[model samples]
Target: MHRIAVLLVEPVVGFDATIAPTLFGAAADADGTPLYEVVTCGLSRAAVTTTNGFALLPAAGPEALATADTVVVPGTRYAPARSDGVLQPELAAALAAIRPGTRIVSICTGAFVLAAAGLLDGRPATTHWRFADDLRALHPEVRLDENVLFVDDGDVLTSAGLAAGIDLCLHIIRSDHGAAVANEVARYCVVPPWREGGQAQFIERHMPADPHASTAATRQWALDHLDEPLSIEQLAGHANMSERTFCRRFREETGQSPGGWVRSRRVERARELLETHDLPVDEVARRAGLGSGGNLRHHLRRGLGMSPSSYRKVFQGS
Candidate 1:
C-alpha cells in the first residue's frame, strides 16, 4: 500500500489536519482492502497544539516522512512560515527528511509552510483566500491563485480554506484509484464525489428575497436534461424569470456563467460515460450533449490532457 504521512505543524488548523487521514483512510478496494497507509507525524513525538483549542498527539516524529510516498502539510499558525516566509531550522530539518520526488500537498494556510521551504517556488498553488495577499507578498516566486478550490500541479498540490481540502483529497483518491473507488469513498463519507478544482473558492451570493424566484430548480432541471440543448431562454422560463434575471442569479449563486457551467457538466458526463461504459466516442459525446467525437476529443484533451480513448483506458483499466 502507498504510505501517506501528514505533518501537523504546531498551532494547526484542527479541521484541516484531520481531512487527509479521514478521507484517505476511508478509501478501500472493492474487496474491502485499504488503499493507503496514513500516518500522522510532527516535528517530534510531542503533543501538537491546534488553533481549535485542542492538541493532537502524533503517531510518529519527523522520521516517518523519510519513508512516505506522499507528505501532507495541514494549515498551521506556526509563525515563521505563516508570516515571514521562512522555515525554522527544526521544521526545515524535519521536512528535509522527506524523500526526493515524493508528492507534497498543502491544505489551506499550509501552503505557507511549503512556500517557506521553497517547495512551491515556480509552482502553481492556492491557499485560504483571506491570506492570499499575505502569501503573495511573502513569497512572490510562488504562483498563487486564491480563487480556485485547489491547484493540482502533478507532484505538488494545494487547496483553499476549510472544505476545499475535502475536494482536493477526493481528487487525489480519484487520481490514484479511479473515480469508482473515489465515488464509493465519497458515498460513505456523505459528501459530493467531485467538485472541479477550478470552481470558485467563494461566491458572493446574496439570498434571494423571494425563495421561489431562485434559479436552483432550473439548475437541477438542467442536470436532468443535459442530453438536450438547454437555451438560456428555456432555462429562464423553467424558473419563471426573465433571461437577464436568470443569468444574473445563476452567476451569483454558482460563480460561473450558465454556459460555462453547462459545458463543464457535459464534460463531466462524458468522463463518467468513458469510465463506466464501452460506448464509442461519438456516441458518448452525443449523449453528453457535446455534439460529436471531434468535440469530445477536444474537450477531454483541453480539460484532462488526454483523448477520450485514453481516458477510458486509464479509468476503466482496459
Candidate 2:
C-alpha cells in the first residue's frame, strides 16, 4: 500500500488538515482492501495547535516523512512562511526529512510553506484566493493561478481554500486508482465525485433581488438535455428570460459563457459514458452531444490529452 504522510504545522487550518486523511483513508479496492496507509505527523511529538480552538496530537513526528510515498502539508498560519516567505530552521529541517521525489501536496494556505521551501519555484500553484496577492508579492518566481480550484503540476499539487481541499483529495484518488475508486470514496464521504481543477475557485455573483430571476434552473435543464442541441435562445426560453438577460445571468452563476459550459459538460458526459459503458465511440459521442467520434476525440484530446478509447482503457482497466 502507498503510504501518505500528512504534515501538520502549528496554527494549521483544521479543515484542510483533515481532508487528505479522510478522503485517502476512505479509498479501498473493490474487495474492500484499503489502498493507502495514511499517517499524520508534525515537527515533534507535541500537540500541534490549529486555527480552530482545539489542537491535534499527531501519530508520529517528522521522522515519518522519510517513509512516505507522498507528503501533504495542510494550511498553516506559520508567520515565517505566511509573512516572510521563509521557513524557520526547524520547519525547514522537518521538510528536509522527506525523501526526494516523494509527491508533495498543499491545501489552501499550505502553499505558502511549499513556496517558502522553494519547492514551488517555477511551478504552477494556487492557494486561498484571499492570500494570492500576498503569495505573489513574496514569491514572484512561483506561477500563482488563484482563479482555479487547484493546480496539479505532476508531483506537486496545491488547492484553494477550505472545501477545495476535498476536490484536490478526490482528484488525487482518481489519478492514483481511477475514477471508479474515487467515485466510491466520494460517495462514502458524501461529496461531489469531481470538480475540474480548472474550474473557478469562486463565483462572484450578486444574488438577484428576485431569486426567481436566477439561471440555476436553466443550467439544470441544460444538463438533462446535453444529448440535444442547446442553443442560447432555447435555454433562454426555458428560463423565461430574453437571450441577453439569460447570457448575463448564466455567466454570473457558472463563471463560464453558455457555450463554454456546454462544451465542458459534453466532454464530461462523454468521459462518463466511456468509463461506465462499452458502447462504440460514435455512440458515446452522440449520447454526449459531441455529434461524432471524431468530434469526441478532438474535445477529449484537447481537454484531457487522451482519446475516448484510451480514457476508457485507463479508467475501466481493460
Candidate 3:
C-alpha cells in the first residue's frame, strides 16, 4: 500500500486536513481492500490546535515523513511561510525528514509552506485565489497561476481553496491508480468524479438584471448535444438573447467564452470516453463532437498534453 503522510502544523485549516484521509482512505482495490495507508503527523509528537478552536492529537510525529511516499501539507495560519515567506525552523526540520523524490501536495494556502521550502521555485503552482497576489508578492520565483483549480507540477501539487483540495486528491488517486478507482472513491464520497484542473477558480456569478433570464437552459442544452455542431449563434438563439448578451452571460456564469467552454467540455467528454470505453479514436471524436480523429488528437494533446492512445493507456490500462 502507498503511504500518505498528512503533516499538520499548528492553526491548520480543519477542512483541508481532513481531505486526504477522507478520499484516500476511501480508495479500495477490486476486492474492496484499502489501497493507501494515511497517517497524520505533527511537527512533533504532540497535540496540535486548529483554527477552528479544536485540537488534534496526531497519531505520529515528523519521523513518519521519512518513510512517506506522499506528504500533504494543509493550509495553516501558524506557518511563517504565510507571511514572511519562509518556513519556521521547526517546520523546516520536519519537512526535511521527507525522503527525496517524495510527492508533495499543498491545499489552499498550504502552497505557502511548499513555496517557503523552495520546493515550488521555478515550478507552475497555484493557491487559494484570495491569496494569489500575496503568494506571488512573497515568492516571485514560484510560477503561480491563480485561475485554475489546481496545479499538478509532476511531484509537487498545489490547489485552490477548500473543495479544490478534494479535486487534487482525487486527481492524484486517478494518476496513481486509474480513473475507475478514482471515480469509485468519488461516488462513495458524494462528489463529482472529475473537474478538470484547468477549470476556472472564480466565476462572476452575479444575478442577471432580469431574475428570470439565464443562460442555464442553453448551457444544459449544449451539453446534451455535444455530439452536434454547436455555435455561439445557435446557443444565443436558444437562450432567446442576442449573441452579445449570451456571450456576456455565459462568461458571467461559467467564467469562459462560449467557444472555449464548448471545447473544454468536448475535451472532457472525450477524456471520459477514452477512459471508460473502447471505441476507436474516430468514433470517439465523432461522439465528442470534435469532427475527426485528428481533431480529437489535436484537442487532447493541446488540452491534456497527451494523445488519445496515451490517455487511454494511462487510465484503462489498455
Q: Candidates' lDDT values, in order?
A: 0.92, 0.91, 0.90
**Decreasing lDDT order of the candidates:** 1, 2, 3
Per-candidate TM-score against the hidden true structure: 0.96, 0.93, 0.91
Candidate 2 error regions (>4 Å): none
How far residue 173's Cα lies from its native spot in candidate 2, in Å, is 2.0
Better of 2 and 3 by TM-score: 2
Model 1, 143-246: lDDT tens digits are: 99999999999999999999999999999998887778888989988998887898888888846888897888888899899999999989999999899999
Per-residue C-alpha lDDT of model 2 across residues 1-318, encoded as one tens digit per residue: 999999999989998889999999999998999999999999998999999999999999999999999999999999999889999899899888888899999999999999999999999999999999999999999999999999999899999999999999998987777777888999999998877788888887847778999998888898899999999989999999999999998888767788888888888788778888999999999999999999999998886688888889988889
Ranking by TM-score: 1, 2, 3
Clashing pairs in 3: none
Q: Which candidate is the best by TM-score?
A: 1
RMSD, candidate 2, Å: 1.9
Question: Which residues of candidate 3, in runs, are more than 4 Å off?
Answer: 206-211
Shift in Å, residue 90, candidate 1: 1.4
